[model samples]
Target: MLKRAFLPPADALVAFEAAARHESFTRAAEELHLTQGAVSKQIRHLEQRLGVALFSRVRQRVLLTDAGRLYLHEVRGALDHLHDATRQVMSFAGSQDVLNLAVLPTFGTRWLAPRLADFLRQTPQAALNISIRLRPFDFELEPFDGAIHHGDPIWAGGIVEPLFPEETIVVCSRPFRDRHLLAGPADLLRVPRLQLATRPMAWRDWFEAKGLVTDTAFQGPRFEQFGMIAEAAAHHLGVAIMPVFFVEDELASGRLVKLFDGTVEERSAYHFVYPENRALRPVVSAFRRWLTAEARSARLSRESLLPG
Candidate 1:
């Protein structure tokens, strides 16, 4: 009977928990990094196997009455117990808990990956699962311990800690900048602007911040990501408003040069966001401390250069 009880795949239970917590599969999907269809299917499969309906759907929203609430109560406890047991067993081999991180793709690849060697050295035997998240996701609904997010936007239900602040500066290939005879800021008007779809208004914001609100901000070909935009700029296809932190190597190598003498803060800063409820987790707390230390160190260096 016990074996039969535990026979069902753990994924079904996970799906149910996620759905019950968020009351919206879409949000759960974002958190779990699973498709909406997949989440719903998992829940449905679990319900069929258990022979009990878990969620009561109403008008495109799910409501948890007695059954779901009770089930969640028990399931949460069970899951916690299971996790504890797993950790206890795995702890013997030092293959215990994992720290799952979801970060912006470009930032993770260009910045975080390099630092991971040091991180691993410090936290020996700790496994790190770094996943790329190009958009905002539901941390509560997902299994991520934490995430590195872009933008200076406020986090409503999660903890938002700054990893760094950034400024968007106009950059283009050296040859392109010179061949176009781009003498300064005003010269940008005659060049092609490479835009990031996520921040379609980045050019506008930067221009406005620099007191150059021209119609050109809205007239660029949009790319889905910063990496693509950067690549196009590296190839001298056009001028790109790129975050300085992301293109440091290119700039240092003189492959990509700042087009203007000035830059702008689109009010967008990078943050380390996670469930506020997760602060109690030891791994979460440790990573936060370590990350903040790095961020503060960098901030201090940047501040040292300022006329403050």
Candidate 2:
């Protein structure tokens, strides 16, 4: 007969449960809003604590060995019980189970909007409401379960969870393309530059990167929302500086095209940010879990496209 097993830390237990259920560390990482290394580390700790190998590592994936499967049966029951007990207490304490979402306009439209259907399907019991706001770290002064913002999580006194990283690129419409002969980033000088009101430093950085200096980077219509900027570019107003990932559908649909691919600048990472006390709520936890998974899926999908 097996001896009673030691209880691992709650977080490691949660990660192990997710990984086991999905049978994929990468998937579990996404769902848990953790790095793959973090998830693996959690499982490692759990395995060491229990003195048994739970996962059989095959070439590119993990499979549940007998030990893993048996442990899962027990861990899963505990997780379900914990989840149930938490939910019962929450329900007894409150009636509104709504999830408030704060989003940047551009990303909301181009990236998250497309994937909204999936989330709604999965979490239909919860109300999903979104508020559009400017980026650069503002989680307070608004009622939201969570917000998606660009740039580094440099804000003080807030909790931030990584969703994914984004790179900005230069793009234009076909009409705006011929307005100037383009050979490189320097060619942007002759084109009308669309700007994000928040990132005034973008033009300076782009020029500095190319060893070129032109005042034209600062000489375009400034807009706050990426949706507006994209619209302006689509109408041949000017070349828009935006995230390539955000505009994937538009690019594929011929609404936009890259003027050049040379400078893929790491502008900011997408982070799910909320108030410092956000971890205390289960709705926030669910949102974090779901967002983490989405980011992971995107990363894997991108990786699969590379020439390996």
Candidate 3:
């Protein structure tokens, strides 16, 4: 005996999901390489089988009904889980480790990219897939295996491995610094300070740490990402407070200069975060070992550069 109540025809469900996602039978048909009539028929059959209207037609636009919206959420999760399970089984059969990792944009570009070659060389049996993500996402719905989070390890359902604390230094174009005398931290208040939207209080924190205060610390042109701020600072638009490792290339080429003599430690630090359940995977363990070691090595290097 088979349980008909528990199983929907996979083909019909796929067609329904695609149509619901696009909200247009024509678009879904094009995506699935089927005729519009066939797509419509599948949705009609699915609605009938479920004993409800999945969608409502208002003129030419198709909108999901309340029931349809709820069903779509569950359907998407099931589909994603099935796909992940299939891939996991394939990886296991082949004895290969596949990791879907998300990274912060600027850190991925300036810091991790240069070191990934070594990671690949040391972990040849593993295949690392990288994607750019700035914030935490749901592991139950999202496909990411882990992420490099640039903040405190406070995310629920994840185990955090501390990488390194972030230390920022103020930097500006050399030409801009040459034109103005910035002999002390107080002089920084006179110039236009570029700011990061993510770190709204960066300048305030840095200034207060140096025993100075200013009203204009929060006043500046704001950028959404670190890379944009770096580019703006390099062009002499304004000064920026950024991680030393992030602006190393600009400093080496003489395009940018550090404005102060001391570094400010930020409250948040970089960390490698993964789901607690997946911590035992061989691939996860390998990456944890390699990246933790790399972060430790980098900390030593950063400490040596700062004045004793």
Clashes of each: 0, 3, 0
Tens-digit lDDT track for model 1 on 94-183? 555578789888888777787778766776767777767887888766777788988766666788888777866788898998899998
Q: What lDDT tens digits, residue by residue, belong to model 2 across residues 1-308?
A: 13344457899888888888888899999998999999999899889888899999987788988999898898889889888557645643433567777788777877788888887677766666676777544556655657887788765656788887776678888767876666677777777788888888887787888799776668888987788888888888978777767666667778887776443647578888877777778777777888889988886675333211
All models, RMSD in angstroms: 11.0, 20.1, 4.6
Number of the predicted model whose TM-score against the real structure is largest: 3
Q: Write the per-residue lDDT of candidate 3 for residues 64-171, one digit (tens) a residue.
A: 999999999999898888887776556645447888888999999988889989987988888866778889887777677789998878877888899988988889
List ranges where model 2 is wrong by over 4 Å.
1-96, 135-141, 302-308
Candidate 3 lowest-lDDT run of ten: 87-96
Highest lDDT: which candidate? 3
**TM-score of model 1 vs. true structure:** 0.66
Better of 2 and 3 by lDDT: 3
Better of 1 and 2 by TM-score: 1
**Ordered list by TM-score, greatest first:** 3, 1, 2
Give candidate 1's root-mean-square deviation (CA, Å).
11.0
lDDT over C-alpha atoms for residue 183 of model 3: 76
